[model samples]
Target: MSHSSTIARRTTPGRLRHCRTRSERGAATAEYAVTIVAACGLGGILVTLLKSDVMLNALKHLINYALKLAGVEGLEL
Candidate 1:
């Protein structure tokens, strides 16, 4: 038998390769759901950190320094 005949026989109908195609449906949707869940978890963590007192104080300090550089008086730092 030639190489082409062997290749064609392996890919014929009712083969294992054909069987796998049916089970591959909805695979993309499962992957999308996993990515969305991970993104939501990370966003929640970042929001909690940004809302903490230490982060807020650092932001306030940065704003005060910027205003002072621009020579605006009475920022109440």
Candidate 2:
């Protein structure tokens, strides 16, 4: 056999040794992606709940201001 052919045969198995089948690898990437999405969704829900309280307070202040401008009485503060 030629020197180049023998070298090529020796290198073929080494190249294949570093490769992995899809099923043999663990599912760490998929698990991480799922955890991240769930955390983001939970955060979004918490922010939505908190935003309602802030919006309600702002509306109450606006209403109070309007009532005062109209010279209404009996509005406490």
Candidate 3:
């Protein structure tokens, strides 16, 4: 057979479909890995921010306001 015929046989419609499916088998795994990494990064950032004095103070102030609204006073969270 000629070289061109050999190449043509490898790229027929059925062969193309099988090749495409095999190549894409890891796509979902790659997507899940990326999502997990992104979630971890976001969690780290949130932990850092929540541990900061500003966020802590804001949270305390909100708690104090809520307590005052509930008829409790002079309590510091």
Candidate 4:
């Protein structure tokens, strides 16, 4: 075939695919970082909520209910 067609066949599609893959790979790193940050923020909020007196009481009640269902004595907490 022609010289230009030979060059296009060898280089163009491969280079385009490589460039797109590199850009998408960089975006994946940013996506992971944002996901980790959001997860950490959510975990912090959950920890704070669970430590509150209302949530503590609710958890204690739930535990006591489970114990009662299992025919065991409930905890005093």
* Predicted structure with the largest lDDT when compared to the true one: 3
For each candidate, what is the lDDT?
0.89, 0.84, 0.92, 0.85
Write down the TM-score of every candidate.
0.58, 0.40, 0.67, 0.69
Error of 1 at 4 (Å): 14
Q: Give the Cα RMSD of candidate 2.
A: 9.5
lDDT by residue (11-64, candidate 4, tens digit) is 876676666554476797799999999999999999999999999999998988
18-39 in candidate 2: lDDT tens per residue? 7787885767788899999999
Q: In candidate 3, how many Å is residue 50 off? A: 0.7
Ranking by lDDT: 3, 1, 4, 2
lDDT of model 4 at residue 69?
A: 84
Instruction: Give me the runs in candidate 4 sitting further than 4 Å from their true place.
Output: 1-22
Would you list the clashing residue pairs of candidate 1?
none
TM-score of 4: 0.69
lDDT of 1 by residue, 1-77 (tens): 99999999887876865465667898989999999999999999999999999999998999999999999989756
Q: Candidate 3's residue-wise lDDT over 1-77, tens digit each? A: 99999999888999776664677889989999999999999999999999999999999999999999999978878
User: In the order shown, what is each candidate's alpha-carbon RMSD?
Assistant: 6.0, 9.5, 7.1, 3.5
